[model samples]
Target: MNIDDLVKGIAAGERRALARGITLVESSREDHRAQATALLAALPKEREALRIGLSGTPGVGKSTFIESFGMMLIAQGLRVAVLAIDPSSSRSGGSILGDKTRMDLLSREKDAFIRPSPSQTHLGGVARRTREAVALCEAAGFDVVLIETVGVGQSETVVAEMSDVFLLLLAPAGGDELQGVKRGIMEMADIIVVNKADGDLKPAASRTCADYAGALRLLRKRPQDPDGFPKAMMVSALQESGLSETWGEVQALTDWRRANGFWARARAAQARYWFEQTVKHTLLAQLEAPKAKAALSELSDLVAQGAIDPTKAAQDFVAQLER
Candidate 1:
């Protein structure tokens, strides 16, 4: 397909083109990387969608919640795109990518698009191509882009860096639950929602909300959150209750950050972070070239045998690369 046609199709919200664009960026081939870079450069500089990062502990019903939340957004006439990051099998390097099946209703909506990418060897619970996928979605005129993490350790902090609003979902549990989550992750949350707040879990969900609200009070607020500390609420994604209110909170926080100039600053910082990551990745890839790899192996053998000091060996490797 012509690259110009692909870019135009994406800007016009052609679903097939958007899917292909995402695939292009996710590929690791050098040619694909060049194409992806050109595609990103063609995209508009201004953000056209709200980037939301949703994360939680395992079994928090993140998929179900996103299905419901995404439907709600669609009903409001918003075009929603979901980039669901699924864990890859360490042995096989494959993922189920079953989020579409899990979010059947939302997936069927013409105004909604869902793509599940494997988090293959990428830490922080997100797919390595997530940032690029988000850019494609925004360029495709998606009004809201939701990034769902794999619910692994440290994922919340990582996703928080990429999103306009970071929402932490919790199950209806007690203070013991709080103990398991990192404080830094909690502090990063712009909003917190206790899911499954229906039936027998309703009371517990309310209590959990209160517990989180209290805990948030004790933590220092992020400088970007001029509206004060994070807000906690209860929602029953299955019953589809409190979803509107939750969305309202998200919008309110987004508005607050934009009004305070924090949004622009945060995006600038994210760009810098990604730029540094690209440079590091490029340098590491260069170090894996055949000649460099052979040199590294020799250095490793020397260091392991104590024939040369580790620090000196590293210096020698750098010198060789320079030469």
Candidate 2:
């Protein structure tokens, strides 16, 4: 399809056209990439929407939280789009795409669109085409775009970069989970939500939430919204409780960044990182070529035989490849 037709159709909120446009961007074919760039450029400029990222452990009820939160956001007269990343299985290298089934109620909402696409070897539990998909969503006029991660791995930082607000959802089950979650990735949450706060789990969830709140006090706050409060909340995604509070926090954080001029700097940094990644990936593809692959094999043999150090061999390989 031509760029103009696809761009116009997507701008008019055509789901099929938007899906096809994302597919084109995801493709590795050389010609398809050229078209993808054209389509990306055709997207209109829009910066008024809120971009929120949600991530947590595998069983933290991410899909459910997203569904409940999405419903609430739409009820408040905002259009929402969810892009949930489903990673490929280690064995089959194909995603199960189970998020849609998990979000049955939100799935039926015409104003809310939930798309779960495979990671396909992309970094940060997201598809390579996700950035383009987000831009497309913005151009199509979604008031809010929520990008959900595959898990709580270090890959979470990748999603954080694209979002205006990064929220970490936690399931405060009890004793050990509190201390256990104090490690690397989960601590970087701009807003932490302790989910499943209803029913029999309420007491345990509350205690765990207190533990996290204490934990936050010890660590230096990353930065602050204009309100001067670190964004944190406890919510029950299944019961549809506490969602409004969560939205309030998200809005406060975004507004703070805008009023403080941090928003411009953040977007500029995001663009630089995006450019670096594009260059890095292109070079890696060439290094993995069959001819280069054979040379790398020879380098490994030479290094193993003690004929050359690993670093020297790598530099040699790079020097030879450029010729």
Candidate 3:
């Protein structure tokens, strides 16, 4: 398809066009990259959506919560877009991509768009093109864009960097699990939610919420959150309870950041971060060219034979790239 058609279709909120645009951006081919660049350039500069990063442990019911939360947003007449990142098989590099099936109701909503992307072994618990997908969704006039990570620990920090608000989801009996999670991830959270807070889990969920609230109090306040430390709450996604309140908290955090000038600064910083990352990616790709590969092989053999030190060999390879 033509670049103009793709840009116009995305701006018009055409689902097919949006999907194609996402596929284009996710493509690794040079031509597709060039086309994606042009498409992004044509998009509106003003961003209007709330970019949220939601993450938790594998079984934390992230998909369920998102469906409930997204439906709530749609009920309020907001267009919600979910960029769900599915974990790729380590051996096959394939993903289940079943988030759409999991979010049956929300996926059927006219105002909600769900896109499941494979992690493709990209670190940071997200797909490589997730940020670009966010831009596309925003350009498509989505009022809220939710990025659901693979929920593996450590790499979640990358999501925190890319989002306006970072929400950490926990399940009942999470007190011990909290100790296992990295303190940095908890520190980055603007809001903490304990899901499955219904039925027999109600009491446990409440306790988990309290435990997280207390833990958050002990950590240094995130500078961006003017409302002080992270706030914790309990909710039942299955029952769809407390969803509105949770959304209200998200809006409150977004408003606070916008009012404090942190929002704009954060987005600007994210843009710069992506720019640096793209440069590194491009350079690394160049290093994988046939000639570079030949040089690398020779360098590896030399290092293995002890004719050249590893560090020196790396420098030599870089020098060859420069030449």
Candidate 4:
């Protein structure tokens, strides 16, 4: 389809058109690339949607949380789009796309779109095509975009790079699990939520929240919003308690970022980072094919055989390109 027609259809909030838009951006064809860029350029320039990142341990009920939260938002007359990324199965190397099933209620909402993508060899827990998907969402008029990341270590930071608000979700447990999470991820959180706070687990969740609040006090708080608190909260996804509080906290975060200029900066930085990564990956791909790849393979064999040192081989390869 032509770029103008595609862009018009997407702007009209046609779900199929939006999916096709993302697919075009992901395509490797040169004509598709040009069409994608032009189509994106033709869309609204300054997007005002909220980009939120949700990440936690694998069993921390992330999908359930999203289902509840997204449904709440949709009920409030807000348009929500969830860009949920499920990790590729290590054995089968495919995404089950189970988040859609987990969020059955939210999946059926007309104003809500839940797109499950495979976290395919990207730096963070997100799929490499996530940025394009996000842009498409923004252009298609989603007021909020929630990007869920995999539970991989340091993956939270990757989510933070693209989101205006970075929320770190945690189960109400202490000890080695907390230690397994890196301190750097802790510092990036604008909000920390302790899940499973209802029924028999309320006290445990409360204590965990206190402990996290104390820990957060030692680190620098992110620049404050007029209404938001940087403190931790205890939530129970199963009981739907504290879900409204969590949503309120996120709203404050969104307002602060948009008001205090952090929102624009965050989006701009994300764009620059993605552009640089795309270029670097593209260049590496160009050099790793056919003749260039075969020559590099020979150099590796030579280095292993002690015919040439690793550094010398690298330098010779660079010189060969110049010649």
TM-score against native, each model: 0.95, 0.91, 0.96, 0.90
Per-residue CA lDDT of model 1 for 1-323, tens digit only, reads 47899998998999999999999999989899899999889976665799999998888999999999999999999999999999999999999998889998999899999999999978887888899999999999999999999997544578876889988888998354355345667767888889999999999999888887777777766687765448889999999999999999888888888988988898999999999988988888888799999999999999999999999999999999988
Question: What are the runs in model 1 whose C-alpha is more than 4 Å off?
Answer: 174-181
lDDT of 3 by residue, 1-323 (tens): 69999888988999889999999999999899999999999998675788999999889999999999998888889999999999999999899999999999998998999999999999888988999999999999899999999998744778987788898898899775356345667777888899999999999998888887777777776688775547888889999998988888888878888888988999889999999998988898997789999999999999999999999999989998999
Predictions in order: lDDT: 0.88, 0.81, 0.88, 0.80
Model 2 residue 169 CA deviation in Å = 0.6
Question: Model 2, stretches more than 4 Å misplaced?
Answer: 174-183, 297-309
Q: Candidate 4 lDDT, tens digit per residue, 18-100?
A: 88898887676868877887877898755567888888888888888888888888888899999888888767777777888
TM-score: the better of candidates 1 and 2? 1
What lDDT does candidate 3 reach at residue 15? 87
Which 10-residue window in model 3 sums to the lowest lDDT? 175-184
- Model 4 RMSD in Å is 2.5
Cα-based lDDT at residue 80, candidate 3: 95
Model 4 per-residue lDDT at 21: 90
Clashing pairs in 4: none
